[model samples]
Target: MNIIQKTDDELLEIAIPMWDDLIKYSNKGQYGKFIRNFSYNLLLGLNEVEVGKQFAKSELTRSLSPDYDVLGFIRRGEHVSCLFRVRSTKKEGEWLGRMVLGYEKGEVKIFAASVF
Candidate 1:
């Protein structure tokens, strides 16, 4: 199925769990699980050592709250960008998290994921 063509509810059904897993794995510093759904290019830009460094240095990343609000969704070309209101378990406020989804090898995958 083309993820970009999916309904908002359908897309959320797929994305939310992946987002949850990303948070879960990140909190545990599990690089492999955190990036398991990432696309090939996305994974190419990251490595275990670099991710470990991030897990060690970024308190916010390490303390991400699993519960997040879906801010919105944007569809462009073959991708769907999921915006989220993310919070840190140890911090006071929220951050914007973006997870861009697209097809890779005929399977759904995260093209990019970031928080700011």
Candidate 2:
């Protein structure tokens, strides 16, 4: 559940589960779970982020895809961040998911998820 001790390969493993869970929850009509993945700073009733997650969730027919690529990890001040680049074509056009994770409170959690 944490990435502090995780190597690059371990971090990549974490991202896959995150991606699978998001798609699973979204497909089950659990948008609330999707919204809860965000960090504290990003909040709103309806906005770009929420819509994008839901849209991606809705469009994803498979739980996980081979199109996902880990964009690597970097330290940003007090936080360590990881990015995963994802591509899916279950819809009319190509979709990209830039999923992000930030290590905080002794655990790595989904801090941001955006798809376009």
For candidate 1, the TM-score is: 0.94
Q: Over the stretch 1-116, how does candidate 2's per-residue lDDT look in tens digits?
A: 34445677876777777776775655555667755656665444358665656556555644334456666776554444665565554544445566667665665667666555
Candidate 2 residue spans exceeding 4 A from truth: 1-6, 43-90
TM-score of candidate 2 against the unseen true structure: 0.57
RMSD for each model, in Å, please? 1.1, 4.8
lDDT of 1 by residue, 22-69 (tens): 899889988878899999998888776877999889998899998899
